[model samples]
Target: MKDEAFDPVRKLVAPGTTVIWRNTGSADHVVDSVQFHDTADQWQFRTQTLRSGDSVVYAFDQEGIYEYYCGLQGEEMCGVILVGDVSLSNSLPCE
Candidate 1:
């Protein structure tokens, strides 16, 4: 991920896929999970403050719409992960 934005603001993957995010910027960045929406797929996850060249890996094991943002940048630098076929009503909104 870059300082201003994630390379791809959205992603579609299988349930077992492992996502690896790298900090390729000149500053720090982090990925933090958004609040849950009362769904079975909601799980807490976050990465430590990532310095330049640092990376984080997360494995999504359920089918759900997972929303997250850069902890350092908040909503201004956010993204969504769509695991399998998820119901729109089952996830928190992200943009």
Candidate 2:
């Protein structure tokens, strides 16, 4: 995480991959998934307050798009993780 933004705003990973996010900026950050659409699973992931130098990790077990933003920041500071071969059609519009 960086000031008012998420570095590598988009990431592509295989299902079963473990992703890590490290806070390399000065501000505190909280990474959390957004429920962009209705799903039976209603899956969500979040990190504890991430101070500078802190890091968080998540495992991607399903094949789909995961959109997230900084709770301390806002949607403007957002990112997406594309698992498997998911289409951008299911993703939020790019800024």
The best candidate by TM-score is: 2
Quote the lDDT for 1 in model 2.
80
Candidate 2, clashing residue pairs? none
Cand. 1 TM to true fold: 0.82
C-alpha lDDT of all candidate models, in order: 0.78, 0.80
lDDT (tens digit, per residue) of candidate 2 on 25-86: 99999998885645312457888999999998999999987888888888778888888876
lDDT of 1 by residue, 6-81 (tens): 8787788999999999999987888888844554345688889999999989988888888788888877787777
Q: What root-mean-square deviation over C-alphas does model 1 reach? A: 2.8
Off by over 4 Å in 1: 36-41, 87-95
